[model samples]
Target: MKRERGHFSGSVAVIGGHDHVHALRRLCEEYPDIKWQAVVLPPDSTPCLFLHEDQSMPEGSFRIQNDINENTPTKVDIIGGPFSGIIYAVEELISQGGSDKARMALPSETLEDTPGLTYRTFWTWDHSTNWELSQIGQQEIGVFNPYGKPPGGFLRDYKRCVDFCSKNRIAAIVIYGFLRDSHGGVEAAKELCSYAKERGVRILPGIAIGSYGGVYWEGDNQYNLATWLRKNPQAAATLEKGVGFQICDLAFPLNFPRSDYTLSACPSAPETMAWMEEGVSWLCETFEIGGINIEAGDYGVCGCSRCVARRANEKEAARRRDVHGDYWSHTDMADNFPRLFNAARKARPDTWIYSEIQWDNLLDPVSLEAQRRLPVGGIYQHTTNRTYWKRISAELTKSYVEELPMQPNVLRCQFACQWNGDERTERYALNAPVFAEMAQLSYRTGMKGLTIWGEPSPWYATVELSYLAFARFSWDPSLQYEEFMSRDVAPLFGGMEAAEKFVIAANEIDANQRLPLERLEALQRVCLEHRTSGEVGRRWLSLEEIISRRIYMGE
Candidate 1:
């Protein structure tokens, strides 16, 4: 990997992979005194932490480890806090294609056995955020049920959320797009989809679409097609299920024996076009989903044989039908997405198709052109860093405006801060006022709606604050983020100072603390650790209220 200029000084060295070179650059520039050992590893086999005895630090000022585990030569860093943090951050940068090392390199479709990994914020630790936010009461501040469960297994929780939304007039709840767990099978997912539809909620089913980091396919969706045909005579599997490496998901996080097999398709593969027709038929009849959300397509270019041929024969395929690189440039996994999806629409006639394209794609040649060829209805993570919330808000609104002809429905997505495994969390602000920033950005950008990654099911004070914050923005976009947060937090803690201080302290924790467990412990310590003088400790401040005070201090 090319090192960013001015990253490491003449002092200590920082060794990481090509992808992290950017982050190292930021860290190095941010902390210039620390010289990076600069051990840039290949895409595969990155040592999580690079400080070893044999490896030398720049300037020799920093002491290195004296002894080495020569026998084991263990390169893995399994410390809980750092491990999970690294997992989350690295995942955000890369997709998990059934392997911990998926991002280590581009995966081969013709693997001995396909690998797959599931990513979701199904459960998080933030118990105090929920408790404290609950303690605040609705009389003084507004709260909302930002997210709800989708069409399947989490029914009880989903209903609770829907009722809350209905009562609060919450604009729209995000229904599930996909689920893969041992507890529920296809029958369960089908049921889940049914329930969401009966309730008239919009379902957000995600398709791997065109990313190298996600589940693409060589079109082997025969399972779905078979199910559709067995149940309904009218459905037909248009194309032969392409030869594929199947994804075997582990039943348990600990026991990853790969019990569940799923087929991922490549957009450029011939099988992809055939698979879509099969997928659409099943979806239209079974789930009756409103639309599909194409997610996280930043996998870069594909060197798959077909893509190579297409790149070489771009001039040749220029005259061929359904062979446009821009439309099918994701490699020969049959990337005729626009064409395939169009076929599905023709088959079903009403299902809406939405694709996610990011600003990052704007910089990548493969996605930049491919995404441009296929106009998207929705945009996730458009311009996250540096852009003003209001500026992005306007831009978001405009995104819808620009794509209205091709994509009628438009919504913006923001992940509310997630659990560090504590209700009262110091782990980090899981989801902060960024929701408001997003709302403002959405409205300003010309978005027709908003998608918040949240739920009413309690986790922590931060989660509660997050939902409340989301509601405030959803209810009124014109409201200033800081002001709304301030107002709600004050009453939650019975004092503006407490709420404001907590927010300041929360930001500090988010900036400094990264380990999930450590962050949680620190957050709990700050929240539960009370003032020693008699009166403060004696007062019955609920954990939720206490967390609220810590998180929203002065807001």
Candidate 2:
């Protein structure tokens, strides 16, 4: 059989539910030049795109099949088990031809694609004052006072984030900060959730169960859980008299005084457990979120007598691990996680409850058993250290088989930017290669999905390239970082040669932790030479200026 090239002729029709239809409309809007039409099936047969639900397609799976005849226009069929899959198919079509209004072409062959991991997610730390300061580069960003109103442009930025996640095939979005008590908090969250639902994305509110913060109530800060705990010292986790309490101290040695003193609640305390259950229930009742992410606060569980007894009962050491010194050994703090999970599930049976487990606790028998005890559908784990990918992957695979019979999804949190107190030079952390390898490893190890931490900034080429590579690799793990840069990254800069120079310059700057004056000038010259006056070109120029001031001048 001879194959013929198919051309899209502006006019297109869609068939599906309200959300699917809305997504098609958005796609049309994205390509304004494409003349889109709505029509019924059978009688109108004019090169129509069919959308239907198929339970067998599996979660996060979508199929695209094109039929072309000699005398008839090409008929495209998009079949998906979930609505998101259908949206993903449409996104793929837009990327191929719809974005360029000049001509939209489709191959005569059928194309079917499914996510390697079942639950690809993205975590947005939009609420943390520190995160906001780091991300927006503003000195006046307030601390995480959830009771206070959101700063200007918060909603706009949040919508942009949702749109970006939708375009990149992210299945879920986990948001942290100020959703419970900020201005229009509940209403705004519900609206955002509804918006994400239309795009086939799930929105989850981050709930810190271990520590007390704005997650609990809508009243004044003094009346909140954290303050309440401070007043009632008996509920606070007891640390050694002279030993300062900091979550980072549990994992690594630090000379800094404890900043979160009396902020964390004791896991063994019955009152604390009841308060956690009540808080989770309240959140479920207040927001229309798809799920809730339970975070293990800044510091690990308390070292009080009650917590010690619970740890001893579990046959686990209550002390911190030797190597990292950050996480406790066989600590019963994790035991309290199941109570929160159960409470969440009881409140909202259909909601997905995610437990953020520390990396060191993954292999611990106590932690694994605690995970099995919950109605957990997902496990959120992260590591800044890529060296543990192989071990992490293997351990997760084993746990999935021998331990968690529920086969809960494993969501790996990958960091794009690491901020180390000093905000000047820690803006961009280029880890494209590391992200690509982890994506591939996740597939090989039977993990469900991975979420990239931090947002992409347009002014930084390194950040943009890193995000682009990570998104591409997540969509298709078979594509290596080198291939991704050559195909996707290089073209943005005009050609392969320009891309090569840019990549080399980026790698050198990243490895040496500084940009030489000569290297900066050389890259600027290259960028100007091949500049097409496009978005990528503008960003490259912007980045050069930023590097010159930030790195060279020590701004």
Maximum-TM-score candidate? 2
Residue-level lDDT of model 1, residues 1-555, one tens digit each, is 432111112343334433244334434444445443456551232223342221222111112111123342213221111112222222222222223221222222211110011011111111111222223321111111112223232444444554343223232343332433321435555664555443323344545443221221112234332232334333221212221211112111211122112212344455544555555456556665555554423222344555555555443234222332222223232235565466546655545454444322222223333344554432322322222333444433464455533333334432232212223322235355766665555556555445555434434445456666665565457877667856765656556776665566555555542335444456556656542334233221333254444445432
Question: What TM-score does structure 1 among the candidates reach?
Answer: 0.48
TM-score of each: 0.48, 0.82
Tell me the spans in candidate 1 whose CA falls farther than 4 Å from its real position: 1-153, 156-181, 198-200, 210-221, 224-264, 295-302, 311-335, 343-352, 362-372, 375-430, 449-452, 455-457, 486-498, 514-555
lDDT of each: 0.37, 0.60
lDDT of 1: 0.37
Please provide, for model 2 over 1-555, each residue's C-alpha lDDT reduced to its tens digit, 9 standing for 90 to 100.
857767667676665634377557765766767666655553354666777768678655777788877777667787876647777777777767645664567756777888776666766555432222233433222223333324443455556666766777777777765354443556666777777777777787776654635364333443356666766667776643333233231223334344432266666778777777777777777666677777665345467877666666433443343334453332343566677777767777767667665443444444454445544454645433333444565656633533443355464543234422223333365667767776777676666666666444534667666666667777788886667878887777877887787777666655654556677676667656655676766756755665566445742
lDDT of 1 at 329: 29
Residue 29 in model 2: lDDT? 68
Model 2 misplacement above 4 A: 7-11, 39-45, 70-74, 98-103, 127-152, 178-180, 212-224, 227-236, 239-262, 313-323, 327-334, 346-350, 360-376, 380-416, 419-427, 551-555
For candidate 2, report its TM-score: 0.82
**Which ten-residue region of model 1 has the weakest summed lDDT?**
111-120
